[model samples]
Target chain A: MKKNILEISSFSNEKLKYISGLKEKKNREKSGTFFIEGFREIQRAQISGKVKFEYILTCPDCYLGENEEDLVSSIDAKTILVPKQIFEKISYRDRPDGLIATAELPDFSLSSKTKLSDDPILVIEGVEKPGNLGTILRTAEGAGFHKVFVADPRLDLFNPNVIRSSTGTLFTLDVFQSDIKELYPILKNAGYKTFAVTPEAKSLHWDADLKGKVALVFGSEQYGLSEYARSQSDQYISLPMKGVADSLNLAMSAGILMYEVLRQKSQIDN
Target chain B: MKKNILEISSFSNEKLKYISGLKEKKNREKSGTFFIEGFREIQRAQISGKVKFEYILTCPDCYLGENEEDLVSSIDAKTILVPKQIFEKISYRDRPDGLIATAELPDFSLSSKTKLSDDPILVIEGVEKPGNLGTILRTAEGAGFHKVFVADPRLDLFNPNVIRSSTGTLFTLDVFQSDIKELYPILKNAGYKTFAVTPEAKSLHWDADLKGKVALVFGSEQYGLSEYARSQSDQYISLPMKGVADSLNLAMSAGILMYEVLRQKSQIDN
Candidate 1:
């Protein structure tokens, strides 16, 4: 251990207050850092090798095994010990495991000229809920989409809730934010076929040709895609609604569409 | 109006306290009543004719349209006008629409001998989250499964969160709660094949026969279908996960499978 151990027992500690400030998107953006919580998510983020940790804080009482010790020692990041009460105060979860970290935001950007594989790319528009955004990211990774562009996201992509709900899959994928207006041309120039998922579409989602360099687009829970997203797409598709519900949740819709893309691609491969 | 307009200006009002107490599952069950929030959900519940409203509380400051007035007038239940501050205390949402209600639990029970359509039936075993339960119910309804049996649910079907998240679809569908052991024999005796969705199952979900009377079974997020559910299923199926995520969200998996059942059945219909 580096012997720079900063003990924080009081809620009045400036560093503790600063760490708590990371909960807001404005603070995170200003600091160019985001927070990650829980054992599984932090471990996954560490293993992904994409996160550049600035600080790791742990409560001594919550330590489980040698594995956690090894994890703490392996990283070059500054490690701090926090009292259990202090940890609880900073935690968003009702029962936290007492491991938390701050890391620089993922180093990536959305550009018109960016190259993509022949596999499908996900484009989510105006996804307001962090939980929904995180679930969509997890589903995207599971369905083998290498890149997802979030257009006009209402929630910060690196919000702690998003990171937690994603099970840290957010670190494992190429997620970029670009407005739909700017993104349309980039996809078009890349020779990608864009499909917008909407309730009003006549083409059933599975019926849409989701093969070979396709872009599957989705929208928010309260509102479907904006006019720009709807009008710019090459094709419009919808999931079948045989009963009373007019739509599925945004994350559910994205997951279904991503898998459909996978299913079609797999069928073609076979 | 019967002019019984009971004013609850104080949060300490016994009835207000009682209404607030319904937030707990035990209290809801003990009182033989549950809470419903917002104008749209309350309206849907009322229009379904399945909900027996005991009281309708509205804040004059939040009333929207002639529709709200019409809806309040149409119900035979006792109506009360609560001050906005008191309404805020009883409201679950931050931005209260100014309408809330208490209603008697729907009169229904699960039995092995209950009638079901020839179409597929959905059985969710031990779903822990109220949100997931609601999403599954909404998806189940959208996919045309007229009835769903939640086997040993962790939360009540009529929980406010479940009711809200389902977009009030709970009132439109036939939902029941029973154990997997009990549900199995009922489906088997009803000439319905039981398909349990599991991560370990080798058979791809799409390749399975989803036609005729089939009970598609799922498990909770924490513990996927119990051992009894696994052992008793007529067939085991899994959604193809092509990348790093070990599994999708419970609701996402359920939604994808439900839609697949619809797609396959629709193909046969065509």
Candidate 2:
């Protein structure tokens, strides 16, 4: 056992209760902390230095991989050892990796304290599913997007599903959440050409000059960009719909649009 | 009740047992029928005229939409009426639209009878998740690809999640599934330059000549294309991974690559 490790014997321990409490949005808000599970997610969070984890729970016995002990020793936070049963009780995953940590939620508001970037930004509006938001973040990273902003999100930004699906890019990327009113000014001041994605748009996505600084907005398939979002956006662009499916999945839309920006900027066009 | 409608009140009714039993893959294969839910999905399946629905279960009591009776009226299949409790019992969705149908699974094997499209083909290899397959189908439709072939799929072709996530594109799109050996010859004979998508590949996807007849194969992120798949492909191509994320989500990768093919072919490139 590590120097800081303390074994958790009972299921009803306060740490176990606290770790599970972050599952609820209200508890996370009140406590100002959310939970991070999985080995890769914690490592990314640690390297990013954007958020602080108060402590972590590790069940070496339940671990699937050989590196759990090494990762525990590397982090600056306190580590609490756990039995397999107790770890499984607090875990969100079907196959637990034997690591769970309570992390202080970063301030996602567009305040002066927040670091803004010149790299192409991806914005999602009213994302209804955590999986969609997580995927967009991962896609955004793959497409070289440095920053992402969510406007009027339906799911909590720190939802564990988001972290799980993102494969930890949620920590590596600059993720911010704010309402529509708070969103546009930052992009405008940053001199970003905001492209509002809609199926009804006149300009096809590839037709738009996505080069230079830009922010791409994706909305729900059922209800597109809010009236306010449409109004704030500089251009209305759409992916070409050739077959019966009128809209691509929300994450898929983000992937296509984000890459289009990269494709235009990379001097690799036709 | 309509002329062919039968009310199912008892939970132990054979009709109810039979409906719920299709959840298992063996049952779906044995009975050769899978379930679909949602109004928009059913409407699309009806219009596609490809697969045949054996029957539909409807709960007028639990209906959130006003158009259930009208949709039930249009289909030729027998309608089984159920109370709210029974509808919820057999439902895969959190909120059932009061419509669930057992549609005969179309033979997905690539045989001489299979319809081939000159349009760009999208093939997924060893897909581990139904959601990824479903999203790829939806994206393929939006990107104008008419046919989708799955090779060595881990999940069943007609998995309920695939149907749910595809939003009934499963019916509208010509879907075929076969082993890796059965796949290559069809593409080879069709004169397609198969682009095998792997992160390790030298040629970027956009840089590839996606013009005319092409088949793009996306593999699992953890496991790239099987040895036979790599050996069979005409070109190994990759999406530019610019940031910390080593790979995009399987569906997102499909979305990006599918759009790239469309982007190059449509004369929309820079």
Candidate 3:
């Protein structure tokens, strides 16, 4: 396949500006697109076959895989070539992997037949940190969760940091963007118990029946689970903290809770 | 109690340079001190009473405490009166809380008779990310682990990000640093069934006997557990990934494993 490498010399280049604007949640939603950078992340996106690649931009020396080429051909996106220096300027990290791909948001709908087994679901509410969100997605995937529904996510789901932090797991997971009101009904209808994780909760997390089809709810680090979300939850559960710390990080809580679900499921299966 | 407010107007302030340098691990070790910023974190340090506070710098308008005069009189440290602008410059976060305290590193050594439960211990190896390290500490503390030991930590425990991420639990928990080789004797002596968490591991995480006195080891995100660490382990355990993503983040894995330990213990306890 013949490739056209377009050198992005100016930061004012329309494409560069568009990609840069994606760092903001508003811009990503406005364009109905998000940017996923780095060679590894782009490769994961391609392998997942969920996101539609608008274009793949990389330095002259970078290799584009056959799958990537097929994706480019299928989407009719011109593989824009970027100078190394220009790519560095647009990259998020200190060292640019020399690859960035603009991808259309995957069309995701919460499955009506969402399986609620002994394994619990992880529900995130208003998670602000991109890295925390990404880490949670990666953890959920590792803990055997098939779906992660973001209820009123404060940051853009496709933020480059989120992509990098998730180690590209975000590309493969079922990530739904909706308000708690929208998600609560679906979870309830699916017969999934919702447990809101909070410091003020009287019951310890271990005391909760995590073996059931459950959705573990967490909020931002600052305000914790929102009052509305907390009120809507089936129960409030907390980790047993003997130390001086008040609460765990959003991702850590999700990881602990998801694994609890897995542990319970394994015991049941045995 | 008369409080002296030191207003640091110049960037050339030696104290400012010293505090900023604490951001690096080398500088922190060389100086034998680290800075904890923000009101809540500083309060946590005071409550834990693990680390000695060398000094407290804050704006007059900032709430020191209800008995501000009494609290200031109690500590034998010089109080610096800084303008909000000056504090903002020294602060790491965007909104400076007008409080930064220099703290001596706490002696985090485990006691000879440190209680070892039938549950597992988390040994974090070469985790570079402060947030990841902090999250792991928070989870370990929350999950009621016998103890958490940092095996070749890449980032200093006193890094502001680690302090913030752990919600100041770093000060209260039994967190000590050691190389991977040092853990083998300790595990053997303590009768811990050693398990290394790695993607290459054939045994699933659930397959391990987490209810026993197990020591679960994890490495950096960039590099999986060192070959030596892997070789020393009795068994290798990995989370079952149903998706295309190959690995989970280090902290997330730690959190999940910690909870698994908690789940097993809870089951046995009940």
Total clashes for model 1: 0
Q: Candidate 1 on A133-211: residue-level lDDT in tens?
A: 9999888888889899988988788899899889888877777888888888888988999999999999998777788
Q: Tell me the interface RMSD of every candidate, in Å.
A: 1.1, 1.0, 2.1
RMSD (CA, angstroms), candidate 2: 2.3
Preferred candidate (DockQ higher): 2 or 3: 2
> Tens digits of per-residue lDDT for model 2 on A1-270?
346667778988887788888888999989999999999898888888887878888998888888888888888777888888888888999889988888889877777776666778888888888988888888888888888988888889899999998888898988888887887897898788999999889899988898887889888655878999988899999889998656777888888888889998888445
Q: Write down the lDDT of every candidate, Cα atoms only.
A: 0.84, 0.85, 0.76
- Mark the regions of model 2 whose C-alpha exceeds 4 Å error after superposition: A268-270, B61-66, B268-270
In candidate 2, which residue pairs clash? Answer: none
User: TM-score (chain A) of candidate 3?
Assistant: 0.85
Q: Write the residue-wise lDDT of candidate 2 on B90-142 in tens digits.
A: 99988888988888887778898875667899889999888888888878888
Rank order by TM-score, top first? 2, 1, 3
Tell the DockQ for candidate 1.
0.77
Q: If ranked by lDDT, best first, what sequence of candidates would result?
A: 2, 1, 3
Q: Can you write out model 3's per-residue Cα lDDT over A1-270, one digit (the tens) per residue?
A: 555656667778898888877767788889998888876677778777887777677664544443444444444356776677777777787766667788888865555555444446788888898888988888888778877888787877777889998878887776777778878987887788889999889998777778868889998867788778888899999876655556777777777777767766778878
When 1 and 3 are scored with lDDT, the better candidate is 1
